[model samples]
Target: MSTELVSLDASKLAELIRTREVSPVEVVQAHLERIDAVDRRINAIVTVADDAIEAAKAAEAAVMAGRELGPLHGVPFTAKDAIDTAGVMTQRGSPIFKGRVPDTDATTVVRMKKAGGILLAKTNHPEFSFWIETDNLLSGRTLNPWNPDRTPGGSSGGESAAIAAGMSPIGLATDVAISIRGPAALTGVVGLKATHGRIPMTGIWPRVPRRFWHVGPIARSVRDVALAYSLLAGPDGADGFSTAPLQLDAGVGSSPGRPLRVGWLVDAFAPVDADVAATVRASAEALTSLGIAAEPVRIPVLEEINALELLWKLQVMETKPAFRKVTAGHEDKIFKHVQGVYDTPDTSIADFVDAEQKAEQLRDGFAAYFQRYDALICPVTTVPAHEHDAAEFDIDGQKVSSLHVMTATAPLSVTGLPGLSLRFGTSREGLPIGVQLVSPWMAESTILHLASLLEAVSPVRGLHPDMSRI
Candidate 1:
């Protein structure tokens, strides 16, 4: 029964709870027990919230009283540690802030609670969310549930691992580059990097590249991702970028009232694995069965501006300084990957200004592409999850850097557009391979609608790792 309870997505769980077939307390307890049973093998969730049951009990009372319920009413959600939770430890997977706790919930967290979602726990992340993998001096390391020898991807890895392991149904994750989407792809789940600033980052850390930081949902199902996004995207008045008075509509089952065109590209930003490339192509062809125009696409600015390198250069200036300020005296407590941040060469004033200009060109390039196609499909990573701490990978006889994991994703971050990660294929090694669906800025509805359609045709839909092996 506990196994079945945890396997249910937030959407189905809420439906059951709302109908009184299940209670909020049962949902919360099932997750807590799942955590105790599975987290030891993966080290995904680092801090479990003590007040989770109390909050669930309150939600039950409201439901029994015949009061109004939100879409996610009585559901439980976990969050990446970088997101602040009032009174819950938000150490950011670093020993530098060993016992740090926040005084208020992040705008997203508060919104989730208002929607009747209970805060379940805090998941692991890389030190300050700066590295390519999720591990820290504080929480040890997080292993991929699909293959224990592989990584679950970094930054938002633990959030993905927890959901994939059936510990939590849906959770909050932020992306600076590929944090949210990359991890979700590696774990065979769904992740969304909403239009930059669509969701506020009021109580999150490492806001160095403020324009690149995006907060959204990671869930096991596409509908759960849509439900979370609908309940959370809005201006909270505290974040400067989130001040846009935009009303979001998730067009899941319905397409725009006109013909839809999509373009798929796999070899854009890096040398991708053959399997990964094939997945992107297959996803595009699947969209055609729905009467949409799907074809091969190439946006030149991707290689010319080189968003992956540009993002690294910009971060060397912004993220490095902020990291140094916090790790000043506790440098010894930091992980080697984070310590390497300081070793990065500083970006010169001229190059920094040039990267900023190139960012505009990248955005202009995508704007032109969208003029012809409603959405774009591409590989989320060059390959599936790599072996943990493995240095590099061989892609079609060429040696590729591990940094290529974020190459396909950093482009959207540069353009401040929306990207969704959903599993559409599996690797020869039986790991999940995901195709990214991207849309122009604030066109989240189009991407969601397309992802919903693709989800119906996904070859690996509803597949998960064998938890008994873990």
Candidate 2:
């Protein structure tokens, strides 16, 4: 019964709770028990909220009293460790902030609680949430649920692994490059990087290069992500970038009045695995069967955009100085990856200015492409979940730079566009393969609508890891 309850998506769980078919305490206990049973293998959860059961008891009382409930009433969810949670440990996967707990919840955490979602636990991440894999001195590492030897992808890998393993139904995650989407792709879940700043970044760490950072949801379904986005978006009076409102009532359905047009690209990023490319092509073909016009298109600007260079510049020029100031006296405690940021050559003001100008041009180029297509479909990464321990790997028998993992994602990050990653198929080794859906700046609804259409035809839907093996 606990396994069945944990397998249900957040929307279904909320429905059962609202109908009195299940109690809030039952839901919370089921997830907590699942975490205890499975988390030792993956190490995804860094801190389990001690007051979760008490909160669940209060929620049960509210339900028994027949009080009005929020959309996610009694549903349990987790947040990445980098996001502030009042009275809950948020170590940021770095020893420097060990045992740290915030006095107040992040704006997103407050909104999630307001919507009646119980905070069950905090998940792992790379130190300072700075790397693409979930490993740090603080919490060790978060392994892929599909294959214990492989990574779940990071910096939101722990949240992805937890959701994939059915320890949580939905979660809060942040993405500067591919933190949210990459991990979701590797773990066979739904990750939405809403239009940058659609969700507030008020309580997240490393507030530098604010333009590329995004707060979003990771769930098991498109509808669940859409629901969380509606609850978590909008200006919080603190994050200036979140001032613009989202079109909550826009066109978001599997069947629209007019057939949608989608552009598909497999080699947008170099050296894509043949299996990964095939899966993306299969997704595009599947969309055509749903009466959507799926065609091939290319944006040469994708080649022109240098994602790693921009990220390095942001790290050296903006994030490093600010982060160093905060961890001044405890330099030795910082993660080696983060400490390396300080050793990087300082970026000149002129170079930083030029990079910003190039980023604007890239955004404009994508905007112009969107004028011709309703949405763009591409691979989330070059390959499926790879084994940990190496910085570089081979793709299609060719040795490539390790940064290829974020190549396809970083361009969209720089543009501040909305990007969604959904499970479409699996690799030859049975690992999940995801395709990315990207739309113009504020057109998140378009991507969600298309994702819903694709989900209905996805071969990987309803397939989950066998947690008993863990």
Candidate 3:
């Protein structure tokens, strides 16, 4: 019964609650019970909300009173620990901020609750949301629900695992480079990182490098993400970046009047795993099969910029100061992953300026690429979910540093473009593989429209990780 309750996407759950077919309390309790039963295997949820059942009760009372409901009314959702939740312990996966509780929700969290989505729990992450795998001094580590030996991906790893393991139908997650997309791909779920400014970042921590940070929804289905995006987007006047004047149309169960031109690039991040490469190709082929004009294409700046390095260089210049301030007199609280950042040499003035210039050019390059195609399909990571704390990755033939995992997704992060990650294939070991759908900044609808169509034809659409072993 708990499994069935937790399986419905947030959109369906909201509809069920709205019609009185299911009580919000039943929905919330089922998730809570599921987490209690399975979170032991994943370590994904660190703090279960003490008042989740009470919130569900309040939602039920409103329904009984015939109150008008918000879009997500009565749906339970989890938030990455890095995002603020009023009166909830948002320790940020660190002992430095142990017991820290925010006085208000982040803008995205505020919107989630405003839509009647009850806060269910806070998931784990790397300390300060910095690592490639979700292990920290505070909450330990999060494991992939598909296999215990494999990682769930980082920063937003716990959030992804919880949703994949059926502990939550959907969640709120943040991404600077690949937090949302990578983790979702590593697990088997759908995650959207909207155009940088489309969703406000107010009330989220580690605000340095603010322009690259995006808050969006991670769910089990495309329509649920679209529903969450509609509720979460728009300016709250608190964040300068959140000034997008237009709203996303979603365009679900619909298509554009013209044939949607599509492009796919796999070799740009050469040495990509054969499985990952095929998944990207399959995505493009799926689009072509639908009568969309699809073909191989490249954005020159991806090769020129080496975005994985550029993102680190650009972010280090801004992140170090914030780190110093937070860990001042508390250096003992720091973790190795974060300590590595402090050990890396600071960018020179010339190098920093050069990176900033390259970033603008990267954006221009993607703008030009989008002019030829409405959406681009690419690999979200070089390989499927790997084992935990590996020193390096073996991509195809060549062994590369762990950072290579971000090579495919970092370009979009640097450009502030909207991207979505959804499962389209499975690896030899049965791990889920995802493809990324990207579009020009603020035109999330185009990417999402393409995503919904791809989802319809996805070979692995309804496949879930076999969690029974764990």
Candidate 4:
């Protein structure tokens, strides 16, 4: 019974708590038991909150007193370690910040708590949340729940893994260049990266290059993601970039008159796995059954665009120096890939200016495309989850750079558009394949509406990783 309780989504859990069917204490205890049983093998959760049970007791009292509850009352959620949690260790997957506890919570964390959600644990991430895999010098590697030999995807990999394995029903995640969406794709869950300013990044690390960083929700269902987003979206005054107010209408895409026009692309990047491509096409076809006009459209910028090149250039010129200043004497403590950023040659002001110009062009291009289409559908990664410690892998008999994992996602990162990744299907190996649905800035509702529709027919829906092997 506890195992089944942990497996339900946040919405159902909240409903159970609202009525007399279940108490907050039982829900929290069930998840904690689930974590103890499985987290040893998955290694997704890094720090379990010490006060979680006490908080659950209080929440149970509130229910017993017949108090009004918030939308997520009594539901437990995990957070990526990159986000701040008051009195909880947020190591950011780096040893340098080990034992560091913030005096205050991040805006998202505070809002989640205010909405009656309990912070059960902090999930793992790569060092500084910089790498595509979830391994750091602090908490070690987080193995995929689906296949223990493969990664869960990162830097939000741990969040995805925990939710997928039923350690937590929902969680918060950060995304810059596929950190959130990529992991969701690999783990067969739902992840959202709303418009850049939709959620405040007040307490998240690496606040430099603020234009690309976004805080969003990762959960088993799109409605839960939407529920979390509604509570977390707003300006917090501390993050200057989070000034735009989101206008979300519950009925935006529900009207029969508002039929969606979606554009589908299977080859947004090179060396896409055949199965992954087929899943993207299949997702588009599924949308067609719901009165969506799914069409094959090409965005020319993607053909010539090197997303990583632009990303590295921008980071080297704008964000790297600021990061270096913060971690000056702790060079040896940082992850090797992150240290390589400091070792690499710095970009000139001319090159930096050129990259910024090109980014604007890409954003403009996507904006134009949105004018013709409600959303664009594409692969989240070139292949499904790969083996651990793999620097490079083969796709369709062709050896490709390991960085190809970021190929489909980095372009959207540059554009600061809203993107959501949801489980579309599975690979021949029984691994999950996710497709990204992207829309113009501040148009998260459009993509989410489409995602909710896809969720209704997803082949991998209600599927859980077989943990008995672990």
lDDT top scorer: 3
lDDT of 4 by residue, 1-470 (tens): 79889889999999999996999899999999999999999999999999999999999999999999999999999999999999999998888899999999999999999999999999999988888899988999999999999999988999999999999999999998889999999999999998888899999988867788989999999999988888999899899888877664222455576577889997658789999999999999898877787989999888866877888799766667876886789978878768867788989889888888888888878878877887899999889999987888888789987888899899988988888999888999999999999887787788888899999988778999999988
Candidate 2: list runs displaced more than 4 Å. Answer: 248-257
Which of 1 and 3 is ahead in lDDT? 3
**All models: lDDT?**
0.89, 0.89, 0.90, 0.89
Clashes of each: 0, 0, 0, 0
What TM-score quantifies how close candidate 1 is to the native fold? 0.98
Q: State the lDDT of candidate 2 residue by residue for 379-399, as single tens digits.
A: 898889998855787986899
What would the per-residue lDDT of candidate 1 be over residues 340-389, giving only the tens digit for each residue? 87888899999999998998999999988988888899989889999988
Model 3, range 76-107, lDDT digits (tens) per residue? 99999999989999998889889998998999
In model 3, which runs have C-alpha deviations exceeding 4 angstroms? 248-256
RMSD of each: 1.4, 1.5, 1.5, 1.4
TM-score against truth, every candidate: 0.98, 0.97, 0.98, 0.97
Candidate 3, lDDT over the whole model: 0.90
Worst 10 residues of 3 by lDDT: 247-256
| Steric clash count of candidate 3 | 0
Question: Model 4: what TM-score?
Answer: 0.97
- Model 1 scores a C-alpha lDDT of 0.89
